[model samples]
Target: MNKYLLTIFTLFIAMSGFAESPDSTEIAIKEIEQSLQYQTGTIKLKEGHGTLIVPKGFHFLDQEQSKYVLSDLWGNPEDNTIIGMLFPIHVGVLDDHSWGFTISYDPMGYVKDDDANTINYDDLLASNKKDILAENQERLNSGYGTIELIGWASTPYYDSNKKVLHWAKEIKFDGDSANTLNYNLRVLGREGIYLVNAVASMDELPEVNKNLDQLIASVQFDNGYKYEDYTDGDQIASWTVGGLVAGKILAKTGFFAAILKFWKIIAVGIAGGFSFLWKKIRGRNENDTIEAPTKPIQEENDEDSTKS
Candidate 1:
């Protein structure tokens, strides 16, 4: 009787192992492939300010679906400030590796570039580190992980010709094994700034920087909204380049905390997400289905059509 019971237990363990095999997981994933969808091409920004020319090897997620991914799927708090998202063309919403970056507009008034030439990034980084330390308790109290600024992955670079400011930071979050790469691009405009915040693992900095120039060039402000269009009566942003780099604007706009909390999820997800999407995208001619354009026109109320 004891031998019979032991044999039954061994059989149950064997069956359980088979049930959880990788092949079964793959079969389940394939079954839901038809329901999974992704969007690419041009994505119009809020208030008809401009359009992000979603590059050839990328896709865009509209505001609502983007919010869901950030808040529900990735476990970040809901952020209404996010206007849209840019994802690699190969990845879908369910992919676990990475989701790419978010696009947000801050109508904080025109920022002056007077201080761009003289600001010291080393000092700015030190100041930012102090600020992070000061805010860590607040983050802990809010149920989020504390972050340490490991230093700049890429120092601030501003293009006066294009009115674009770009920077990258290496950050370490509590309990996370990998460091987070926070790449920021701010396009100054007549009314405010267009922000592209891309978070990924530190290892992806090269890939992220390689695409940064093209992405920055793709964002075009409307005719009357360019940085040069700012008039005498237009409101001026209270902060300048130094303030922006020191995380003053980020703190004021409530993005500093959100970014810190979300990088942990991004670090874990990007590798798997990129790999899985690459496989799916390589399986088909995705470019043949989506129109790749230099500057695409905005479609009225087109956000709903792109929903998966």
Candidate 2:
């Protein structure tokens, strides 16, 4: 009877310990969230470009944390192309499954809008698929999975009045279980363009589109930086709306292929990174917090203004 009771007590203890593990994990997540100090409200963009009015249901991660999340957590190269990040308010900072948007600016000079209504999207899509197919070999050689452009999740639409070009692509990364939805928003300006790229699963495209209008409305250029402010002497970007949709601009930025690899990491992070971060955070003292770093958003660039 004593041996049986001891065995029963040991099993009970084991069960209790297992039950407590989840609670501990939850606590760790909460702590990490608190430490991150995620901000909300209007976040001013670098170089007097504009301000991002972070929507009511989202929070903004500043430049430093954004870079860390992309480079360290998401396994992308440490590039200054990232200006900041927009995260859903309901999700934890480390929650990878939830969709978030990365903001970047390309000072590739004024992008002319002459091709707004003239280009054929069907032809453009065909050309883009060929370009992607040709690039797949390089991606494979580099150890990144190849991608297939399934179709446009959301057709290209330009708001000429707002100078905002928005489109979405349905992409399948080789070996990925679910298709990826790449939503692109280009906010044209006098000096360059602001790129808002949202990476999410195809299933979440509807949810992403639902918030598109609000997100587009939230960004505005400062005075004298609007597209209408462009002068005849101002430099023009080598590409146009059609090229933008075709990923030509991204290719010049040298981020096109890296983006493919980056998204893979994002998928893995969402699927598994949270628990890993939870474990790391749990090892730290409960009282510890990751103080938000104060860093300027602008980084130095020496590239010619005419290049895109």
Candidate 3:
């Protein structure tokens, strides 16, 4: 009986400990979903060129009668005149104590084929990768601050005429572990909407790499929104990523464990009751009284008076 009781008590303690640990995947998804829901209205696409860059403080926007809304860092609605396609980039969560990081990207819209095809083949085919870095360095030296390189990858892109000329770069980031995850999709060229990508990190936990591919896959251009519609074939793109993050957030938040916490509460109550009963019993035994006091009398004097 004692062994059985001890086993149950040990199990109770173990379960209580498990309840304290939190999951990040679960937390991130919910957070992502909440952010998406509030994001309503239309996003006015901002355009940029290969050489002539878009001005700073530019952003996506949507006025009334739109399903999405975007603003500049200063909260001003982005201008539609220069807008092209929406690119949502960098979506993630960062926690300091756990040490984590995540980043992702999604692309959309179509740029002019001839314009996109104008790539510096000689520069790209050059044997020295350092040359590319050197050029980036020159730009930094001129006016741009120190540039931090994350990771980059190039994928093939084809136009309606089956002309393969465009490519996309996947960029990552590094910074304070506690910084809120940032997602930015700057429309460099119109082809496809770029999914929002971001990196998240926690100080103690391993970085939870954000999967941009999933977000990218979620995109679907509205009907007749493709390059073909504007140029030759089709250009419409459409996608949704809230669900992917939602799953991760659910896992990380320990929401599953929330149900388990109910059992923990019961265990705690039983343990507390046992402790109270044990204390009460111990106190009663420890405070037991030994004996009662009695009084003496003047019996001799009373007998003498009776005899007289």
Cα RMSD, each candidate = 12.6, 10.9, 29.8
Q: Pick the candidate with the highest TM-score.
A: 2
Model 2 agreement with the true structure over 1-308: per-residue lDDT tens digits? 11222232344444443333444544544564676658887878875389999987988988877765554334344457777888788865445465678787887788878888987889878876786677666555544456687888888998999999988777776666677777788888998888887756777678788888899998889888899998889989886766677654221222221232333322233233333333332334345344212221111111212000
TM-scores of the models, in the given order? 0.72, 0.73, 0.27
Q: Would you list the C-alpha lDDT of every candidate in the order shown? A: 0.60, 0.62, 0.25
lDDT (Cα, tens digit) per residue for candidate 1, span 1-308? 11222232344344443343444444434433343355766656774388778877777777876765554334454567778787776654445445477787777788899999999988988887887687666655554556677888999998989999988778776666677777788888988888787746676577787788778977788899999998999999876866677653222123221232332222232223323322332333244443211111111110110010
lDDT of 3: 0.25
Question: Comparing candidate 1 with candidate 2, which one achieves the higher TM-score?
Answer: 2
Error of 2 at 267 (Å): 15
Ranking by TM-score: 2, 1, 3
Candidate 2 or 3, higher TM-score? 2
TM-score of 2: 0.73
